[model samples]
Target: MWRCALPPLHRYPTVDELAARAAALAVRSSGDVRLRRVGVSRAGTPLWLLSVGRGARQALVVAGPHANEPVGGATVLRLAERVLADPRLTAGADATWNLLLCLDPDGLRRNEGWLNGPYTLGRYFRHFFRPGFLEQPEWLPDGADGAALPETRALLRLQDELKPFFQCSLHGVDVGGAFVELTRDLPGLCRRVAHAAARLGIPLELGPYDTLYWPRLGPAVYRIPPPCPRDLAAAITEAAVESTWYHPQRHGTVTAVVEAPMWGVTAVADGSPPADRDGALRTVSHALRRDARVLERVLARVRPHLDGVPDAARLLAPVDDYLLVCPGLADAWDPDTADPLRPLPPLSTAHLTALRIAGGRIAVRTAGLLHQLVTRAGRDPAGALPELDALIDGWCAGYRDDCGARWIPVARQAEYQARVVLAAFHLAGARSGESDWGSQPVVPMHRE
Candidate 1:
């Protein structure tokens, strides 16, 4: 009864359309799946949380804190539809399902252009919009008061109100294949999750993004590295992070971060040494460094163009500051630091790495936003805006030339993430029952 198939995702729905569709679905459904507006976005858009089934236990699944990551939105919709039609699909679930699709509507609205059609790299970057990391809902402040988005506050309240048994924060990437994050090492469950990802046809990002500095649990899944002690405060709302923010001592909660790429790179899926030796790892590291430089240069050029052009400074400055933090994302892959039997670092990949693709995506957005800034300046034939545009144009061209990625179907990625959610939920059921999924053949998950 576990349905992993997703609707066609060649195109995406606008925020308004997606919200309306969700609302309409709720209205038409009678018994189990009930939807309510949990909170409102700063832009006044309604944020709905759909509840399915009646049970004491609960599972919280959130998607799309970042507007550009629309794959999560697709995943949640399919899941809700599937669970509503057949509540038994949740078979042994002792919990209720609280599914939230697209928590950040204002940011998603800013990305409207690339949402509907043409899920291509160029179009996506051109219309991309993600807020600074500190401003994101998942990382909202817990201690010394700091600025927080309304969407963040809403989720915090929800997390506090209904501390669930499992949390699956669905996310997506653009460059590499797929990667996962779990709160701790549950090898059997990890394998189950990995197998579900394999069915989606994308390889695991052996060299994952963001884990370069953190400890990893397996080839593709990494442990949720701890933040400073301040993050554990009682008010930190759902653990201050989507993966580890549930309860005291994790209190019977399990979480996973499922990130899939838009493009399929052989290196991302492969675990063996490249024919060119460590060339692939180097290629990935070099890309990150190059991306950092591109972002720095783009930020410099766009700074001067922002005066009196209707929210230009407010829109661009924080993003500019955030880009500056990209350079230090990873340390150079030192073979000395690699595991003794492993040819590369524990998390290193052969061909395309997640950080490489992630860096390229970020650089493209930085350049694209700079171009937007220039365009907003009207006809500046003789000003710095035109010169800046010209520079960013070259970066954009170079980015496309470098990636040369074939955009995979979004539905495939969504299906994979959704299936992982299902896998995690099943794992939760097993956990509460105090058992494992028994033994199964380990799928040779990576090609090398």
Candidate 2:
């Protein structure tokens, strides 16, 4: 009985490190661990599909589906080992597990610089590499000779071929506690999944309800939310739901994505009673307007400087347009209904600071990318990069000053995420069986 100790969770596993871990599992399992080369990345990195456990129902787990959210890969690797350490964990269950670890390796490679080091707020924000919305794997264009990366093509083929009955991809956000997005509304599944997460000490995200058009499944669970991918993507991106949603040519299947916070901000789940409800709602509305204005002002400030940058009109919109997008999509629920999501948590002073740090970092990175693009395209004949660090630095310094930040261990984030999903997968595995064998095997995994 061997349990792999989780590394520091604040940092993520490198692509090579995770790949080697997968190969090592195969060796330890005496050839039972089957490694499939789903496809090769653009940079020649092998995209691996690790197949372990045996059962009737097919389950596919995509980790690191979004390159910027790297912790999913670590969580998947941990879950994979969990499944392997005890064969009976899946014995007599319905699921045969398959995982695509780091589906976008090129993007993963690009983000390697920030994975291991300086896991500081500024370091993460400045170093993070988020592809333009269209280039993201979740919404990659599938047309002939489209700008799709090599890895996207491989995933399309694998998904179409496997036609999995259950599919999900792992994702996490830079701030906030855990939340889930479901393709369908199953209250029973929600209770089970949410409770599982709670036992792990992971709080449900009860922040501002920004998902206005989607069905609120549970406390933090939103179902088939809209402001759909195409809503924002159409203007600046070629992203569409047809490409984004899991359609294995079947019905009665469920797909889920869980976003875990990189750090613990206890304020995310504050459902405390309030004295003045109307005033609270007014404050919330005021905050939304303020955020929108701030974004607009920033965009205005940067507009003139963007002239030398290419695609300035199309791509740069999201840089500040995200403000408009978010406000337009704010939680517009009537106060009469059980509007629990609205009153759950006030953005703490510290949380707001962290959120600003994320926003500011993203803004700086956006400008930095534009600077790189303009120079690389020879739009800037002098090869000069746009100046942004000083502006970003100034804001970060202010953020640090009245700062109330907490650095939750990377292990806790990964464990809370892994345990909940493991419980859900175990539940799915049990759904295919007649009797419940879940209660017994988990102890060994925990204490052995």
Candidate 3:
């Protein structure tokens, strides 16, 4: 019996390197891997497309859409290989494939070296210190033009052209477990994936209250206490929740996106069972096979709705507000480790005030201050701040029961120390809405 080998999938690659790799695979597999330029990176580097297999239909899978969360890039590369080698996977009766792998080259290049480094225990932990997007090779808009980023443009173009039957964007969070967020209901698919995890000895926490394995997009994936439905995308889009993704076409198709947690995969791959590099690879291989089965089952059951699903973006506002409020504060209830990497801290008074002010201006209603804090923090994290290094380290140490630090269960820890710093930033932003931080000038501090 051949066991799968775990390859170092965390390593990030530059646009050129990724393109070359895709190109190489395409060459090796001949028609199995077709290389073409989808778009250029923000920095003007070419982003390549790799398509394998044959079918009348197409499925577009994108990885590394964000600059920071990049586990999907590796997953895509592996999936590409599998599709090329396994004729059964692509040539079956309903087979079709058009994989769009690694959209944000600029983001990946910034930390590519660290991403590709050794996969020892120490190396894994060391990755937390790698710099964020300020060092990224990608160009980010100045909040004026979101998705103005070139990579996003290419992605939108692909969506316009392929109008795929299935669409998934691969993203990973520091904490949280694996979960799939469908554009629409894929009940059997979720069950298949969940069962696959269980079979692999990976923990499976489904249904509401499974914060570690929740999705914000579809209904019924995350159940807040008392059975409240928490749809991340729907919550964000209160103004309209009826039609989203691509306008529902009468003769249209369904798009399925998988929001897999990097840590969840890693924990399953390298947890107490001690899955080394090779073991992790095998786990991934098995997991993908299960994913295929789930997708096939779901497709067989649900007819695609031609009308586009509702674009529920308004619901995300409160969640985004809560995330901006603190670091690691939101992770107090996760059943996972104390600190996997990025944890949401509590919201500061400044952030609360900002939310209040913004809400009042927009006539939006929200829960009481404390409840808002807990609920918003509970949602998946949107982003993080820089000063969280020490707190994260301490939490990680606590997970291992280090002698120097007191450990708290992830769901139990109080707000993070970074909350104070975030509050300060909010205060700074609020005080001088127009002035830069340096110009507004807060007092400097010296360490004792």
Candidate 4:
């Protein structure tokens, strides 16, 4: 039987908050959930691992690699707790599971205030435009002379020591959809995972990143695309590809990668909520349970094939495209390309056409505001939140028309828009009455 004691939605834990919760839970269950500090993050934050059901062979699941996407971290921690709370479910599992719950502490912390802090609505808006990548501590590679970031070095050491049979690094795509990759064959397993996700009410759609969501149209909207494969590998860069499972097929240790949909804990019509707590928890909890069930079934079926997976020793021609997209951030958001987060300058004719290309309903006023904020955001986000939020609301309201052929499912899209709105609200709450920079007082910057 399920314990049913999980916290309500209002109390859903953020990445750091979950760490303390996981640590406490591990301590309480001393024999079941063993907590270990495997490494320190680039910011010297402890990278925690919670182990359950000890066995000879091991499997690893890591989350929070990028930080802002902390749902996977929270999900893994909850899964660990569930495992400890219910041993029979995880008992006799051929492989022991080692979960790295929150791989990117530095990135997680920077946005912590967005969920927990208090301020006026105005402050929250300005804070939303903060450039996460530029502030990401993990991306700062090793200095030429001698040293790598302590966190990076520690992770390398752990990989050498543990040599996990399977590795799953979890992250979220703002756009809705799901995708999975394995170095070699894991047919029955991937399909089973999809089946379980469907049972939990998540969409079964899987594809490359570009095909996952319809392209943007105007303010606060996206287009839904027809069925297609979204190249997720081509989306982000420097993401431990050399060390993940695909590394062999290309050159890495990560064996499997799965991209989950972008929905939040609750349901929202556009992006605002009824502010219901229990309802959201019930929905999300069911999803998590379903995910676990899927993973369990798939692992059982795939164990026999693990030994036969193509080894690094195989001689094969290098696939250029896979190699090009393996760099995590580079693949996701190319620095040289037009920044997705940044919009065109307000009132500019070119700005209108860009929004038109993105597709859906066209709102001249909303588009102009969002365009200005995104443009100014490239320079100063703290000054742009309020305007951003107003723009976001407009976009959210116009989602149906504005969403172009991007594949964001209707339900998940509402959830994502709500999360984005809440995120904007949090940023708007960062400060009160503002100081002067230009003629216009700074308003919330909502990207819609």
Candidate 5:
């Protein structure tokens, strides 16, 4: 096990703080570390990229692709610091590290209200901000109708320049066990990464909601599925594209998405087949439908007041997408309508169901942002705010009672994520047949 203590973070750092730290690290490093301005965000915040180590191969680590998921930002800083302190980490992988500190600074700044601390579910939702699907930099499709955001373009430019052998996008869950999504199935890699997280006392997410359809490599480790025809058609209709889908084909980069959780519950680790699979599926489907209805009602009430509200379209984008597609999502979970030839869907566990229910937080976040927009526009939300607040409150309470969700400390979360990254880095190096590290096993690193 590659053992090292991750620096304890009392709270999530702000965008400025992250930038300053990256600058400081580069300045203090001995020529091996370099920092550069990659691109400017839509809001004019300069996107910074830190290049650390001088191995033969190239690897890219991107953090904070989604504004609400800040854990990755912390992971990036920690990884950069660790590799700088012990170059052997990257040397073993035979790779130079290209770390993008934060991909969505504008969206991250909107989420700063809850970044500092009190990592409670309620507070996170209160200050949460996630851009709409098309608004996300990473998921932007190539040759889409509209121009790619500056952040996406910056990543694309880096991809062209480096054609990295390995790319890891750090992502996090608000409430669930830890999991990972890999672009390729490198033998023993998933198990090694999962064991690293498990050693840190982080429960493995057996069936994460987002990767439910993806093929499982091991416990909590899934293979990122290709963009389905349905998804591609939707992207075409929306004039959007997913970069992850095309990046592998274009660059032959083995992409790995490491997902840690701000909060975790034991139920998510349960992999026992549900005794009543159809009933469990129906229950989850019904809950999703119910949440969608609540969001639809709130959107309908607030739609009239949205005129002239700055960013109203962006704020409502997710809500609209959720409302429009939620019914289909719910139906997909319905066994009656499920494809006969498709493998059995992930069995619903209490934590998996709760994670699905917590999807309502997106609606809650939308309502909160809409309230601000409406208030700024000098118009009332017509009771939408209270309804959404009630919805969030109910979800939080359920998270506590039903799912047993507990806040995972910021440092521990970062440690688990860093371990996964290191393991993947070594594994990717070995898989590339460019290094001898594969001959050495990834010994399990336990928390001391």
Candidate 6:
């Protein structure tokens, strides 16, 4: 494995800080780096496209596609600095690097409150702001031409312009373990990334969670599943099609999404079969159902008060989506209907439980957003604030007591993310027979 030294990071940087760093790097590169304003966000924030190096093949790295996930922004900045410092990293990959930093500046600004953090669950949820699927640039339906967000259009324009051979979208979870999703199952990629994460004291997620239905290539690595017929139909009609799906179909781009965790827990790392499979499944299912109900009750009460409030629909869209889809997810976990031939790993319980808590956090966050909207509109929050606030506090305390979650340092998370991306970049080059991948060192930023 190639080792790179990344500068230790104490906290996550804000969107403006990341933008400034990118600009500074471009200025310091003496014409080796170029920065351009690609497009403007929904709220008119400038979308930046930072280009570095030159090669036969092109690679695109996108950070902060999701507002709640900011680790990627740091990864992109650090990786850009490292590449500029050591041109051989991209030179050996035989690829020019194009990095898009902070795709959702509007949503990211709402999340800045806890970015440079105490890294606690409570603070994160309190300041969290994840837009609904309809608002997320990365998952807009493929045919929604007139409806596409400006950020989405910018990314689409980049893909068409660069026609990148390799893409890495940096993403992370608030808790659980680290995993990677690939558009193509490149041999040994998973092993290398999982090993690197393990070396960094990061747990490899072997559980059924976000990529539950995806095809697993190895521990913690999954191939992005193709859109099902139903999903394709929905996309043609109204639903969103994820970027992971859109990239490969349009450009045959070998995309890798690296997911790290802010809080690491061992439960997601354990691969042993669950002792009480049915019990674990039922427990998680019950939690999801309860969370959905709680959110529903709160939303029903606040819906009338939010009828004409500005930004109310956008803020409550996630809650509405959750209430609509969460019940089906709960029902799908029916232990009685589970495939007996294929059992879940022990991590399933912990991973599913973490997801449950995440659901609760979303509910609380939605209620809080609603409360703000109602208050601003000169209407009462209908006594929902106290209940939601109590839930947040209770879940935070319960999570601490149950999981013994460890705060994965910001630097460590970035380092692991950098390793995965660099390794994948190397693999992409090797597969293309463009360069001597064996001789290329995986470079990372060192502390000044």
* Cα lDDT computed for each candidate against the true fold: 0.63, 0.59, 0.38, 0.40, 0.75, 0.73
Residue by residue across 1-448, what tens digits does model 3's lDDT show? 1112333333444456566667767776746568888888767877677777666555566666655456655556656655554444455423455556676665566444346555222233333222222222122222213445566567666766776555555544333334444444443454444443444333222221123223333221321211123343323222112222332222254434343433322222212222243332233334333333432333222213212323222222332343332222222222232254644233222222222222221111111111222233443132221212332333344323421112112111101111111122222223333223223333321111
* Error in Å for residue 162 of model 5: 0.6
Considering every candidate listed, which one attains the maximal TM-score? 5
Error of 6 at 370 (Å): 4.1
Cα lDDT tens digits, model 2, 317-373, are: 435444544443234311333256544334333233333334443444554444444
Query: Each candidate's TM vs. the true structure?
Result: 0.81, 0.74, 0.50, 0.51, 0.90, 0.89
lDDT of 1 by residue, 7-31 (tens): 3444556677667666766766665
Q: Evaluated with lDDT, which candidate comes out highest?
A: 5
CA deviation > 4 Å runs, candidate 5:
1-8, 91-93, 142-147, 231-241, 337-355, 358-363, 371-381, 438-448
Q: For candidate 3, what is the TM-score?
A: 0.50
- Those runs of model 2 whose alpha carbons end farther than 4 Å from true positions after fitting are 2-10, 140-147, 186-201, 208-212, 225-230, 233-240, 249-251, 272-387, 390-405, 430-441, 444-448
TM-score of 6: 0.89
Residue 334, model 5: Cα distance from true site in angstroms: 2.2
What TM value does model 2 have?
0.74
The local lDDT score (0 to 100) that residue 37 gets in candidate 6 is 91
Candidate closer to the true structure by lDDT (higher is better), 3 or 5: 5
Residue 29 CA displacement from its true place in model 2, Å: 1.4
For candidate 5, report its TM-score: 0.90
User: Which run of 10 residues does model 3 get worst, by summed lDDT?
Assistant: 410-419
Q: Write the per-residue lDDT of candidate 4 for residues 1-448, one digit (tens) a residue.
A: 3343445223224666767777776666646678899988765788888877676445566666655455566556545644555433245333466778776676566446443434222222222222222223223322212225555555555655676545565655433344444443332344344443444455433223232233432221222222223333422222321232332222223254545554321111122222543343333334333333432343333333334333211101111222223233222222233246752122222222222222211122222223333443344323343444565454444332433213333233223322322222122222111211122333332121
> Regarding TM-score, does 4 or 6 come out ahead?
6
How do the candidates rank by lDDT, highest first?
5, 6, 1, 2, 4, 3
